[model samples]
Target: MSELLNNSHRRKEVLMKLLMRLHEGESPDTLRTELAETLKGIPYAEVLQVEQEMISLGMPAEEVTQLCDAHSSVLSGLVDVGDAKAAPAGHPVDVFQQENKAILMTISQVRQELNTAIQSSGEDFKKSVIALRTHFNHLSDVDKHYKRKEFLVFPVLERQGLTAPPEVMWGKHDLIREQIKGIHEILLNPELTAEELQPVVDLVIEPALYALAEMVTKEEEILFPMCMDSFSENDWAQVHEHTLEYGFCIVDPVGNWKPTHTAETTAAKVESEVQSGHFQLPSGRLSAAEVQAIFNSVPFDMTFVDNEDKVKYFTQGTERIFSRNRAILGRNVLHCHPPASSNIVERILEDFRSGREERAAFWINMRGKMIHIEYFALRDEEQNYLGCLEVSQNVTRYRELEGEQRILSYGEKKSD
Candidate 1:
């Protein structure tokens, strides 16, 4: 038995047979016991190879995806990782793992809230539900994590001829995303009763949470280890460089990772060229540095969402009412706000796109200051909708002003 397990070809053959049995509707519990008795520990790489082989040998990728969670459950705690390479503190894999840690922490809190909601009644139950909503909102940040993998890591894996796993994993990502959206819809009801919440907890909430946690397991046990083995240092460095474009999930990366062999990345080179050139417009031209300075020098915060609803740009002012980071670049604007308010954002975008609304404005008291926020529909000379611009400012002083001040009073103190 030891010799058979040690032989790579025989080991994979055994794994393939067992997985086929699993595909044929054998109980995971039964198969798990049999696998333990036969092959004490299957290498993670062999499992992946068997999956790839199955796909190459005529099993549809969709079937593999359907069985993904089932097989992962069976192989849970049974895959060997003693020989997996360790990631350095600031490496992209390390950052991904850290984000998983943060995600797991949030999941733990969500479970605690779930338990509390199950055990409580009335306002206490409502409070627990609200807490769950907040945690899930944080969980929604995992979209950024998944996006980084999809946009950065998956392409490299495909180039390496390892395509099936990424496809299967991306399918799983879409499933989790839809589940999270459903969970948000359920949690959005402010007056949900404990009795009403129990069914949701069992049917929708628990399943979603399980899917989330299981994906983390798949990532750490199989995906990250395989990527660590397959990707070159330069590949990792490139991934680390663009990670911020989609943003981090729940937590930021701890340290910066740069390849010792390469001095400049493609993004940096492009940025350098832009900085050295002028940005030409119909009526005027400004250097890149000057344009950036002018934007930052403005008093209010400005964010531009492109026609595709992706966040294209944001200005960094000295006193920004809301925070902005490079991580939000190219992200769907809908995902930027809390789920409860997403409908409002969607309505505004729809109205702007349809030309039914040119502008929308609102004001609120936040943190002892009056904040004014407005959204404007940007259009071309031909009246074609281009995008949407969001402007926000603290208008407390403006609201309190009794008389207009001239330029001569710019540096003068107002009378008490």
Candidate 2:
């Protein structure tokens, strides 16, 4: 029994079995007590790996999401909070830390407004209600922040074989999302009296507000540190680049950050001369160098996925709407989106596969730019299904065009 408990392989087997039971609807309290004794002295990172491995082995995401609340309950007091370190300005971690400050401040203001409005009536209460309403609305922007982590950051972490932690956090993200939506829905009923608003403050708004604030603590202490320790410099650079598409929560990033490689490493990989090559395409043929230059020079960004549902390629643009890095190659496209939108993605893939749909289009107003996104299903000459191509473009400048001009004016021409 001593040797069995001491064995790392045995420990993982036990952990998986416990989690499987938990998924099978075993009592969380019972498992928490039973497993706590067995799991003592196990590194938190190892525990996270256990869960990630379970998910990858075919456990349902929904089931894992449900099990986490209970699973976390067991680890709550026993496990130590993760390391917390200061992130430098302009780094991806720095951006998240900054946003947490803004989010916490908003929650504080909402609390004050709720306190003042609960006892007051008439215009005073109405004014306070309006303030609370706006606070929660602004709080809704947190979804964009969560989406960045869920879509861009998590996939990279999973690629490195750290899957469980991201899955658990993604679950919490879903819970918080539902809470925010509930609070938003409660406020949509404008006819409610001051008395009506009080319950919302107590039941809906406060719980959600507190949850949001606590997640900041979780991100600072648990998520960010683990990511910092595990991810490489280039990995962070990839995350920073992708954040542009999702936009920030309420915080604005000050500038670009370029992670520097070590001098020794750079020296090791340096070559004497550049190797050149050519490529052929249906439209025309271009040298290998020209292919990349053309893709970057174009006003749009693009990503392609093969029929196996794997990400094959993405173009780098002067201003990327979303971040793309070589690390994402061969990753399952399903894992590339937030849980909220993954359903839509699956439906799109299913439709294309079934020959019910050939192409789909969507557009959104992001930070004053009209960003257009389109997906086309690829098929061969014999009509054999191949893959899906995603094309995204910022049409803000194009939308402002008026009148035809035969003359070519290139450099920022202005009409007065």
Candidate 3:
């Protein structure tokens, strides 16, 4: 080891090589000792500064985030991102921080309920469940937080050419969501006994609550700070305006700070840069909201995977055969499935991309309902492969309609 600290140029060169090694498939665990020796005594701001430099040089933020996450094993000792500055009243970060506090409180309550259940028996067991249900339901607020980040904030970052980090975070959001959903399912099970539910409560529920805690820390330490540095005042203003539409997590939005420049100041410069209103296609014109409504009104659930195999959107039909939420949006198609099922998802995308397959269909019986799932390859007029679309429908009622009647349907009568 050198007797003196390296100069700025030397330090940055070392940081880049370290990131490159991790990018080349070096396991974080294997590099832990070396990382500790190299960066352990260094301030956390170094990590942040190097990552910002990478973004400045056109490296994707997500790639930097991935390397950061992989090396997070040593972040506890080496990185002191320092105390997060307090966000003012009505500031976007303020609202998120408030929600994070609420989320943590609920998670604590859930732990208490679990301890009570562990200490109780028979009638006492049922009594503990009473408290458990409330805590579990409170955690549902996380969905709103995630939705705002994905739909409202991510697009702005994408416009700024930072897509990967948001995608990685969305994947984490989905994982958290699935765990929360599992906890909910346990709450709903009629025959669920304390003994049977104990393992799930411990493994699924506790891990999820802790994951949420870690996410809040990551947001405060890394994500939010990065956004503060990267997003423009107008971008923050627009995001702040749209955030209310998705609603809040555990806290309300507060703050009266306005940007120095409003839409008028940025209009002409960002007109086309801004994405709003209707899409003018050759077939027809419909605003995004109208298109969403039409998609929901349709009889089946639909999902669009983009050219890079990222999940771009999914329609929230009334009776969707599969479950979906904003967390899955912009997530990689491969991560959306379980490990065992990922092979099929990858094979399908390969076939679609290679122009070897146009469509794939399958049917199954789920919870006494018939499910018909299909995937189709999407292409441009020149046959350039675009992506894949997945549509799934519940066909139980359709299967039972064996005979047709000449009588007008009830819907037809209303039209007449």
Candidate 4:
């Protein structure tokens, strides 16, 4: 009886070690294959013990991330020789991977053109540089994409004692952001002669492209696989809920994820219980009256027009960069503008309705302030015209912004 008990304990311990390797993504091959069928029912505590032992043995987190992938592949293979489950279409991981792939592809395209422009010097060179800047600015949206992942995805991983991947990914993100800024500076200076372009390419653009490619690989192989392992259906369900708030890089999410029965019930209860009168900020609760007062205190004027091209609402922000009043509400949007521009506004509205144009933008000097204005068409389900939104902000300071201002200061918090 003593011998049997000792042997049973030994197998259990061995089985747990194998499970941890699988979770870390390492493959012990035959050991994993043998235990795969038997490991399903093991409690999470036993699984965690194996991971703890690995850390105690001094294996790094990165090595663990790599090994965990291998382990997952092996066990996944045992389930079916060639039929491992693919990520479902539009799974957050799948969609995020697709976006990352596109970003790398765009970076590659831009780099090639930048290189070609460097080899030639003439009138065409300035055109090429301008084109390069346009393409590079598109990458700004990628920052938004990465930030969404940091806020929405990293928190869940942290709950599982995973911090290494987020730290590494964020570090890479900062590097890419810096490279992009360096490229902007190089483009702005007239010193970028053909001879100077090579250094810019090597120092700024090449590193940026390589970083972009490395990030793609890291996401596909390491970061995403770990997310798949560490997240539950419910966790992903939460990520799907919040991803749209930040938007995407190149792709619009195909369909919005709706809450299931339990989630919907919980959401309904919370919404019902919470008062809508105030927004609770980190500083304090802002009442609805206070919210209006805050908006009315901004430097820029604000307006909203529904799909029908009818003026619906406008903020009474102080220091009105463009004058707006309560009288504009419920007015035909075209009539709100000067008659000389009414036809142009009508054409813009028509194009918006037909989905031919997403935005109508213009900028001009007004009262010594550079006012940048844009109109965006809004559409709802079934792609019906919902209305247009017009936002006009004084961009005198915006156009003059040179280097980054990362830390928020007094004026930085304002967004119109």
Ranking by TM-score: 1, 2, 3, 4
What is the lDDT of every predicted structure here?
Answer: 0.86, 0.74, 0.71, 0.65
Cα lDDT tens digits for candidate 2, 264-341: 244233311222556778999887678889888888888988897777788988878977654345555654664346
User: Where does model 1 exceed 4 Å of error?
Assistant: 1-6, 119-131, 188-192, 241-245, 263-268, 325-335, 338-341, 399-416
- Candidate 3 lDDT over residue span 298-398, tens digit each: 99999999898877778877877777755455556665665346569889999999998999998999999999999999999999988899999899887
lDDT of 1 by residue, 137-247 (tens): 778887889999999999998998888888888888888889998988888787788888889989998888888889899989988998898888888878977776777
Error of 1 at 261 (Å): 1.7
Clashing pairs in 2: 52-164, 242-323
Residue 299 error, candidate 1, Å? 2.0
TM-score of 3: 0.53
The sequence of per-residue lDDT tens digits that candidate 4 reaches over residues 1-416 is 99966755665587656656556545467666667665443322233334445655666655554344343434343322122234567777776866787687788779778878977888777767766766665564467568767898989867887555565466557767787777766776755677777887887788677666666655554456656766777787778766655556655444334455766566556555543567878889887777777777876666878876656677876566666543344446654555346569989999999999999899998878888889888887788888888878888877877766665665666443
The residue ranges of model 4 lying beyond 4 angstroms of the native Cα positions read 1-85, 259-261, 264-416
After superposition on all CA atoms, how large is the RMSD of candidate 3? Answer: 12.3
Error of 1 at 111 (Å): 2.2
Candidate 3 C-alpha error for residue 73, in Å: 4.0
- Report RMSD (Å) for each prediction in the order shown: 3.5, 10.9, 12.3, 17.4
